[model samples]
Target: MFAEEFVVVDATSPLWNAARPFLDIALRIEQQDDSYLWHGWNKASIDAFLQKLPPHCSLMLGVWQVDAAQEQETLWLGCICEVVDGAVCSLRTFVALEDSRLPAIAQLEPGYIHAQELIRVTKGQVAPVAWALFTDKTTWDEWLLAADADGQPTDKGEALAALARQGRCVLLGSQVTHHPHHH
Candidate 1:
């Protein structure tokens, strides 16, 4: 599971401001899914799901079901988001129990749990941008460590541009399954 913390330093923070443009777009995408239900108490459900997940597994969002009748799944719903160049900041999606081989929702599903944690952390906020699903670690590190003349990163806009220049950063939206140590 990937856990990250993003705080709105200020109401006018560039990231905060940049995030606005993408909210409508993200919400429209979220609205496409009908199978996934939107609930208020997502945190508790996520905790329960994580307790039962296997390690190294990540969640996939925007996956279409074979049956067109089924509603598209909504992954990372209700999370705060910001747009960077027309992409949503977050990329993970919540898979429906029916679509996955994983156990029932009652059982702890690590992927579900991790997704929930992400939602809680972002408080339903997502970056107003879409990132490529497969990113290079070195490049990601560089983006994270990049700073401007005042020692500040080039802001989300610059980061997105930099990421594009280097290569597509793989967007990991699911939880990484923890492997049991073999003695």
Candidate 2:
């Protein structure tokens, strides 16, 4: 549910008690095609997720894959969620990674296309799709330079500023607003 559902697991949620069983179910579902199976967790996504989550609620599900066609190391993580009135999503993929890095500046379009395609490929088990994309550092720095180097920012610059996190490491926190038809 991480990439497909955007499930954010809050320890304070009423469903906290069900975490183990929930994770068990999530792990059993095979989201990827047989050939794209991941043998283990991606270390980078794990570190990133831990840094983002609070100390008390660090538990989550993480899996990794090497996309041979793209030569990318893709990782999907789900912390689970408080959604569905405790129904729709018990697990959610929060971050989608390739080569252990966020999508680069020029790669956004294709990145988005691939992500959106997953919903269809995975059978639309999620609600409206929402994504918070973090561009690689190069993209962030380039944005800083091109959008008025160290000066007053423009609208896009302002947006980057707002989405900036962890000392402004993130550039594009854009959310895909289009809601795919849930099957």
Candidate 3:
């Protein structure tokens, strides 16, 4: 471990209260072989969850199953995440999309503990946005830090503009003209 590394600490720990503002959490679960992701919790949800924690209870990060069709019980993991918000942030391990080990919800066997703790991190120590935006660090960095003077992305805007120019970004419901005379 480096002098500073990101790891999961108990949510009830005073360390968590001290660092809560800078944390972001992503939740995943397996239900009857189906994998679902809650993505990241919104601020209100997180705040509420934090307020309800008991002294040493586990932080629910994901789920594990112990049985099949007949068993509807879901297990929650003891985990929490602290990420640095930005493109160029902390280093983390990534599993490629094509990697065989990447769990498929349908194929997962339930009834196990899948508690995963993020490495403990301090403010500015890791980029939380990178974890949410991209799997690989190189790509995440290139996109996040590639801002121009206007603070827009360097590599992504042109394509989106081209799409918008072609009228792809508009929704059908929003395409109606409010002024009937204006056809």
Better of 1 and 2 by TM-score: 2
Task: Kindly list the per-residue Cα lDDT of model 1 for residues 1-183, writing each as its tens digit.
Answer: 113432322344323333343344435434444333222212233234434443323222211112236632212121132333222233322221223433332332224344344433333333212221223334434554454554321354346454654544334433333335343
Q: Write down the lDDT that model 1 would get.
A: 0.33
Cα lDDT tens digits, model 2, 97-174, are: 223233442332324454444333222333332323334434434443343343322344344455443333222112
lDDT of 1 at 112: 38
List lDDT for all candidates, in order: 0.33, 0.35, 0.28
Say which candidate scores most in TM-score: 2
Model 3, 35-69: lDDT tens digits are: 22232223333333334433222221222333457
Order the numbered candidates by TM-score, best leading.
Answer: 2, 1, 3
Stretches of candidate 1 above 4 Å error?
A: 1-98, 101-133, 168-183
Model 1 per-residue lDDT at 101: 35
Reference-based TM-score of each model: 0.24, 0.25, 0.20
Measured by TM-score, how close is model 3 to the native structure? 0.20
Give the clashing pairs for model 2. 1-92, 1-93, 2-92, 2-93, 3-93, 73-99
